[model samples]
Target: MKRVFIIAVAIVTLLVSAEAQKQKVGIVLSGGGALGFGHIGVLQALEDNGIYPTIVAGTSMGALVGAMYANGLRPQDIFDLVKAEEFDKISKIITPSGLRRGSMGISDHKNILDMLDKYIPANDFDSLKMPLYVCVSNISKSQGEIIHSGGRLHEYLLASSSIPLVFEAVELDSMYYVDGGVFNNLPAQAIRDKCTYLIGSNVNPEKYRSPIKSGKDVAMRSVSILIYENTKPGIEMCDFMVDVPVNYFYSPMDFKHFYEIYQIGYKAGLDYIKEHPEIVRKCKGKRPDW
Candidate 1:
């Protein structure tokens, strides 16, 4: 009788452990150019609370941050990289005259790609520390493309962030690809099937106020409007959402205010975690190995 009771207790413990392991958590990051820095802060908050994602999906700037994080970079590591002077040089826009004649825009896409190659340790999907889904706008198909495997990881990351008319499109397998924001700025749906729970970080401003100023403002506001409309479905999919507070003044091209933007995201993340303790409880089941 004693032996049977011990065996039953051991079996129950094993079943509980297996159930915990089965809970897969995913985080979806949205595209917001320079504002994407905020995602790092949110990631840090999640890490601090012992919550780690089993999968990560992102579009545009979100793709850059999410890929780096999923590739084993800590939030602080990414923050330090972006705050350095080297990143400024890499992210700089080429002068119009320096651009190839009749090119789409002034950004030197090669510089960003080179930076990614140097920083990201993995060259392909099979080696990534965790599963990552990068979203890109497929110009040939006129839709969003979710890249989970194949090809160089850095190149795909660049393709996901290649802002139309600002940076040249990336050609892979004869298909032209650009910023995923053009289609799905918030791509929670890409990883919905892969995880049982979802968390999302949105840095795009809810709405642009009046008194639109420069051409840059117009461009930012126009894109923000589209992101606002498109993000609704993705927002609905998230079990927990961290809406990073940002305004129209935060230009996508501006990389100078890293601390400010990151802090905002961190606060928002902490606030959400505090308000929804259940999310933390659910996520505690699976901690990232890295």
Candidate 2:
């Protein structure tokens, strides 16, 4: 009996060690306009604590920040850039004049394309240190058809972030691309089986009250860590937006509110990392081997 107990303990130890060693991580970002901006703080906290993901998949605004971060840009830098910019500039991008009669009208496609040209120009995503899976829903196709790749990256980001009625559907490769969030706000599908661990930062509030509804929904269900507001304890998830208001995009930006919201996400991420032994074992300076 003693010998059997000893062997069982050894097996458990070995299993834990193997699990610790296989820590390739993936991050999923959900869309929610200015509210989605909170993901920046969560991402910064992850990196600050050494929880780097091997792959990142994002929808809408989450894609904007996630792709930028994957390309080596810092969260604060992205924030600063947004802060310095004028609201009028955003208003210009969303101007109704940019849209014309079509299946999906009322778009800011042209202005947004111009902005993309001026800011994040054409780039080969494969050149980045980490792989970035961009999420986009096809507006011209049957319900639930998604385009995960195939075109200029700028086009992907712009299309994924373009909110219907707010930002117009983007025309690319002869197809109209709209926000990926329409079909799957939590675009964890992009990660699929590509990594050992997945961390999904969901900005949408409806998931708290609804069941997983789409392919993206099922993908989010598979993530190792899902961060959202008012979320009940699940397989493995965190709730940080509990106090933050759900309606953030249409509302005007107040620096105080933005800072508060940012800190809410940051602290939530920081605390989660600090509490997880599996994550803390491989701190920032000591990244797990790929």
**Of the candidates shown, which would achieve the greatest TM-score relative to the real structure?**
1
lDDT of each: 0.80, 0.61
TM-score of each: 0.85, 0.68
Candidate 2 TM-score versus the reference: 0.68
User: Which candidate has the highest lDDT of all?
Assistant: 1
Worst 10-residue lDDT window, candidate 2: 234-243
lDDT of 2 by residue, 89-128 (tens): 4454456675566636564566556655655554667655
State the lDDT of candidate 1 residue by residue for 1-290, as single tens digits: 99999999999999777766643889999998888888999998998898888789999889999988888888988888776535533245333432788665666576676667777755897678888899999999898888888658887888899888777788888988899888888898888866789999998848434357788668767777887787778899998888887554466766777778888889888998999999888886655567
What TM-score does prediction 1 earn?
A: 0.85
**Candidate 1 — which residues are off by over 4 angstroms?**
1-23, 88-98, 205-219, 285-287
Q: In candidate 1, how many Å is residue 99 off?
A: 0.7
Model 1: which residue pairs collide? none
lDDT of 2: 0.61
